[model samples]
Target: MKVRLGFVANSLSLWDASPAKTITYKRYTELPKEERMDRLQEVTRLNLEHTKRILYLCAAHEIELYRLSSSLVPLATHPEVEWDFHTPFKKEWRELGDLIKKFGIRASFHPNQFTLFTSPRQHVTDNAVKDMVYHYRMLEYMGIEDHSVINIHIGGSYGDKEETLGRFHENLKVLPTHVKEIMTLENDDKTYTVEETLAVCQKENIPMVLDIHHHEANLSERPLEDYLEAIFATWEKRDLVPKIHISSPKSEKAFRSHADLVDAGFVEGFFKTLKTFDQDVDFMIEAKHKDLAMLKLIEDLSTIRGVKRISGGALEW
Candidate 1:
């Protein structure tokens, strides 16, 4: 199909200027349970507003792949803690299903950072799979045909790559067929890169969600194009690579500052190289400013592709 560009909603709440706003990771974690719910209600309402803005951007230039975070649906029962963020079966999920159709966006529910596939905790991985699987089933049961994806990290590289891949393979076999089909893997900041991720995906017959920034940040020794080519080559049988996590990398900032937007240089160079690739890909901008990052990325794509700014065109340049 067509290539798409969108944003991650995880950092969208950082823009709220409410005096008592506690939608942040710090405030949400430490705030009393009662206070967390109150603030979450406020942020949840704001999420709808943000969705409207996001839809406008995607509609303006016909961007594809709206990468949505699970946090967008507020858990009124337990909104603060990260554990409760995985509420795929919640009532809000049904509402979100309708909203995805309403907005006409192909949405994917991105799992939380705490949902590590190789966590030391016994239940961390199982519970993570539960949340991810639940999201796919709920939307499917709702008859939402927009095509959703659950993006995941290949867990910590830890010591041995082959050993970790073995465990990951076992875990994939346990996943339900529907959930397994919807699952895609992304390169993490520490353990994995697009190439390594593709290796695991190739073995398991799953697709990949390439994060350009993650590979660069992890002391990657290869050229950017090499990584991209390897991933596409490995998944040559697939018609489309579902999603990519893009953002401006702030070397000095932590994930908390994930919103720190990257400039146009990387975006410009990257999309240009993409034109040579034969595979179709969808993208998500994971910046401190998701909406703005998407807008800038679209603009850069248009400039690089040398296309007139037309409404509802898949490629920008």
Candidate 2:
């Protein structure tokens, strides 16, 4: 079995290379009318440049999986703000896309927690669709819409799992079919268990991105091993390996929170279970330390007897 590792947005190795820089709407309004769009463009330009730098670093290190920051363009889906973010940055987007394709990188986006289709309010569902379009537009502009994916949680149970899940299917109709094709669902730490999430993914015919820490924090009645085959089955439609989220808990008291680095001991059993399956998988490290955590974990895991360091960010066992 082999696993390719990656990290979340922002690499600590680079100085001031955060791709999530933002300009608040209030700040935008404070600017003079003539300077409002210019300010937005300025921030976006810096963000795009920083994102390109991060992608270059990834390619140099052979890191194939990366999660793009959702805030690449500020106020992109806001109802009131209407500024062209594409035409001005066509070259930047194309360059980033080119780097990703050249390196065979698997770039993806995970919208904020509010981007969910299970909400009962029509406005909430509308906002969800709009937010999805915002992410999709970024991929489309980069010419990676066909290969990238957008991952989101199963969302709040809203006091009734059965009713809320049914509402999820009904509310999801608002999203376009093409957008839904690249969408994936994940199990949340508090609300949705792996069983519930897998059932929903099966019903919706969408892929599932399993979070190991979340499963440990909020466990279901059956063990995770029982659901592994079904969870992996969700990715059959997509011609890609199954992806999982990896993180260690902050502490016993704040168990659901992510720590700065993943504790190898905490995931040893999970790794053992994964080794039983003869398949390739991708892991997105969700620690607070970002790229540093991913590299550190790779070094720690390489010491194992049967594991071989195949690349800067991949291992085979």
Candidate 3:
């Protein structure tokens, strides 16, 4: 069995390297009309450059999995301020893509919680579609739409789980088929459980990203072992490996909150269950410490008797 570990956006190890820097709508409006576009472009350029630097850092350290910041382009999906973010930075986008391909990095995007299809309101669904298109455009510009995925949750139940799920299926029709092809559904820390999310994924033929932390906070009726195989099977038809999210709780009381770093001991049992399947998987660390937590977990896991440190971000057992 092999596991490739990665972290979310913003490396704590790097100074001033956040790829999610942004300007508020209020602040944007405060700028002089003529300088609005310039300001947006300037912030986007810095974010992109920071992302490029992070990619270089990952490549140097043999970290092949990365989640791109969804805020790469400021006000990208803002109804009042939609703008062409690609034309001005065509070369920059291509360069990022080139580096990703060259280094074999598994890139992805996770839109904010609001970017979901289970909403009861039509405008919310419209906003969801628009948000998805924005993420798709980023991957398209990078020429990685075919391989990269855009992950999102099933969304709020809206006081009715069954009805909302039905509405979710119905609302999803608005998304383009090509965009849906690379989409994956994840079991959130609230609202949806693994079984519910997995059933939806199976029916929709979409991949499921198991977030173990969320699973612990919000469990299914059956033990994870019972559906572990099915969860991994969801990725069999996809081009990429099955991916999971990893994080430790903040405390016993605040179990749903992510801690500063991953507690290797806390996830030992989950690793044991995964080892039973003997399949390769990718772990996206959601710890607040980001890359540092991923590296620390890798080091901790490598100490196990049968586990080998294959790379800075990968382990084999």
Local distance difference test values of all predictions, in order: 0.62, 0.92, 0.94
lDDT of 2 by residue, 212-296 (tens): 9999988999999999999999999988799999999999999999999999988878888999977788989999999999999
Model 2, residue pairs in steric clash: none
Candidate 3 has a TM-score of 0.99
lDDT of 1: 0.62
Cα misplacement distance, residue 196 of candidate 1 (Å): 1.2
TM-score of candidate 1 against the unseen true structure: 0.73
TM-score of every candidate: 0.73, 0.99, 0.99
Candidate 1 vs candidate 3: the TM-score winner is 3
How are the candidates ranked when ordered by lDDT, highest leading?
3, 2, 1
For model 3, give the 10-residue run with minimal summed lDDT: 232-241
Name the best candidate (by lDDT).
Answer: 3
Per-residue lDDT of model 3, residues 1-317, tens digit only: 98999988899889999999999999999999999999999999999999999999999889999999999999998888999999999999999999999999999999999999998889999999999999999999998888899999999988999999999999999999988999999998889999999999999999999999999999999999898889889998785789999999999999999999999998989998889899899999999999999999999989988999998889999
Stretches of candidate 2 off by over 4 Å are none
